[model samples]
Target: MLIPFLIMLREGIEAALIVGIIASYLVQSGRRHLIPAIWIGVLLAAALSLFAGAALQWLSAEFPQKQQEFFEGVVGLVAVAMLTSMVFWMKKSARTLKRRLQDSVEHAVHDHPGSGQGWALIGMVFLAVAREGLESIFFLLAIFQQSRDWAAPLGALAGILVSILIGYGLYSGGVRLDLRRFFRLTGMFILLVAAGLLAGVLRKFHEAGVWNHLQQVVFDLNDTLPMDSPLGTVLSGLFGYQAAPVLGEVIAYVLFLTISLACFLRASTPDTSAGAPTGTAMPAVTSPAASSPASNA
Candidate 1:
């Protein structure tokens, strides 16, 4: 439950930020008329994500045991890939995101005047929302499959509601968020979650009879900390804990965490090149739609 809540919160904030930034930019440049298009795009994206998730879940429910395992494995694989990419991409681009967005707005409004402008912005907003929405669906689906508890979905719903409040506060100039610290912390947690998903994917593949090597049990902790226990269930839901993990699962989990963490840390390090510091915490941004011209700065 906690895991799903946190993941959804992070993902929700991300989607809200993208839409907020774009909407802010449009208003700033005297293109307030296009604002409705942004909301339209958001609604369309939400509908699409809901449909896709429902379809996948329905299809998987009808599959045989082995086929179901294979489907789960494939979904987990995609979720891992998307989560990894999102972490790295945000780390790389968070600083420039606002500026690039503003630039894109300029191009969209100026390069193609009239109806084309609205379409361009709609497309931009649609893609942005859809990317985050789809990512959340896959990640949540993986969690839901494992935990199979009512709390998981409820937690996710709570997270989304809270994120919407936060997003609205930010937009209304009522909230100040240290986005840099937020992303950094969440990114680390997400990496751990992705590692667990990857391990789970491997197990699913084995269950589906796609791979059989390295199946020896590495350790057993059932007597001490069984996965079905209260604490064990929390850990399992959060980090994919196992009472008796296979050798392959252990190896894959360790290797993924090692390499991924190394890269993430290195990327986050303050660059000392040219005697100039880099990777400073981004200052809390004022409402981008605030009347004050310097609000965004």
Candidate 2:
């Protein structure tokens, strides 16, 4: 639930920021007429995400037990990779994201010069939102399958609600943000989630009979870490806790965390090389949409 909450929050903000950039740029350019198209794109994306999630859930219910576990494991692993990469990608390129989105929009609009809700603009917005929305479906579905708890979706809903408020505030110049700090903190928590998911993947492989590396129990602590206990539940919910993990599971988990965290830290630190920005993804300098004409410095 924690992992899903954070993933949704970050993804929600990214999509919102991109859409806000487009809408703000349109208004600033006196192309407010295109605002309708923007909202249309957002609505369509929402519909697609909802439809996909519902349909997938329905399909999963029809699967046999083992098949269901296999499918869930694969999807969960994919979600972990996607969400992890997304965080770091945003960390590395968020500063450029606005410019890229802006450039794409500008190019599309330019190609269709003197446009009134031009097909190009409509398609651009649709593609942007739909892409993120579909990604969200995968993350949500993966988490839902793993926890099998209703709270997972509810937690995601709450996270998104909070993120939307924060995103809107940033867009409207109602508040200043420390996005660098934000990403750093959440990124750390997510790293733990990835470690847990890695263990989960191994469990699935064992269940599928693909890996028989460690059939013996490493140790059993279920007596103390009973799933019914609050702390144990939290650990289980976020880290795929196993009362008795095999040697293979332990090795995979430790190696994954060590390598993943090292990579993340290496990425987060300042790079003195050419054109590497000092901050995480941030608002543009001197853009009409920015709160001030000056840069953050």
Best TM-score goes to which candidate? 1
The TM-scores, one per candidate, come to 0.94, 0.89
State candidate 1's TM-score: 0.94
Instruction: Please provide, for model 1 over 1-297, each residue's C-alpha lDDT reduced to its tens digit, 9 standing for 90 to 100.
Output: 888888889888888877777777777677789999899899989998999899999999999999999999999999999999999998888767777877888888888888988888888888989999999899888888887769999999999999898877766677677777788899999999999999999999999999798999999999999997999887888788899999999998999999999999888886677463464544223355565321232
> Candidate 2, which segments miss by more than 4 Å at Cα?
114-117, 275-281, 284-297
State the displacement of the C-alpha of residue 205, model 2, in Å, after optimal TM-score superposition: 3.0
Most lDDT-accurate candidate: 1
Model 2 Cα displacement at 30 (Å)? 1.8
- Least accurate stretch of 10 residues (summed lDDT) in model 2? 288-297
Superposition-based RMSD of candidate 2 using all C-alpha atoms, in angstroms: 2.6
